[model samples]
Target: MMIVTTDQVAGYEIVEVKGYVKGSTIQTKHIGRDITAGLKGIVGGEIKGYNEMMTEARKLAMHRMVQEAEEKGANAIIGMRMQTSTVMSAAAEIITYGTAVVLEKIN
Candidate 1:
């Protein structure tokens, strides 16, 4: 499906607005990874482990959001956005949301 951060997609007209669609997932930090991250912090470098974890979480949330749009017969999603928050000391939540729409190519 086509997804954009803008409200409009070039050459395509939004025929129907199916409202907002959202998906979220919660993830926890691995203890081993946390230890590694702490060491990396002291050394002053990028935290690859946490970065990978959040990247995967974001992808999963986006997938679910896209699935919801597909289920509603939407061909595209506009105004796509992501939100994140820590659920606990070790866990965090990623939320993906967008406006689902039926788009038709403009002739």
Candidate 2:
């Protein structure tokens, strides 16, 4: 499915609005990674473990959002956005949302 952050897709015209679609997932920090991250923070470097976790979370959230759009008979999603929020002490929630729509390619 086509997903864009803008309201409009360059080569496709929106013909039907299927309304809003959203998906979310929660992830928590691993104690082992936390320890690694703490040491890395002191040295000031990228936290690969946390980065990988967030990347996976985004993929899952986006996949769920796409599934919802498909269920709604939407071939595309516009104005797609992702949000990350700290839900608890060591947990974070990732949310993906957008307007589901059917698009026709312009000839």
Candidate 3:
């Protein structure tokens, strides 16, 4: 399915609005990785472990959002956005959301 941050697709017209669709995922920091991240932070470098974790979380959340849109027969998702917050001491929640729509090629 097509997903975009903008409201309209370049060559297609939104034919139907199918309401909001969303998906979320929660991820926790690994203890071992956290130790490594702490060391990295002290050394003043990028925390690869945390970066990888966030990247995976983003992908999972987006996948779920698209799956929900597909389930609703949406051809595309517009105005897509992502939000993240700490769920607790070690866990973070990532949410992906967008407006589901049916699109038709404009002649």
Report the number of backbone clashes for model 3: 0
lDDT of 1 by residue, 2-106 (tens): 989999989999999998999899999998889999999899888899999999999999999999999999989999999999989889999989999999999
What Cα-based lDDT does every candidate model obtain? 0.94, 0.97, 0.95
RMSD vs true structure, all candidates: 0.8, 0.7, 0.8
- Candidate 2 to truth, TM: 0.97
Q: Model 2: per-residue lDDT, tens digit, 52-72?
A: 999999999999999999999
How much is the lDDT of residue 13 in candidate 2? 92
**Per-residue lDDT of candidate 3, residues 1-107 (tens digit):** 99999998888999999889998999999998899998987898888899999999999999999999999999899999999999899999999999999999999
What is the C-alpha local distance difference test score of candidate 3? 0.95
lDDT of 2 at 9: 84
**What is the overall TM-score of model 3 with all chains considered together?**
0.96
Residue 88 of model 1 has an lDDT of 91
**How close to the true structure is residue 17 of candidate 1, measured as C-alpha lDDT?**
99
Better of 2 and 3 by lDDT: 2
Residue 39 displacement in candidate 3 (angstroms): 0.4
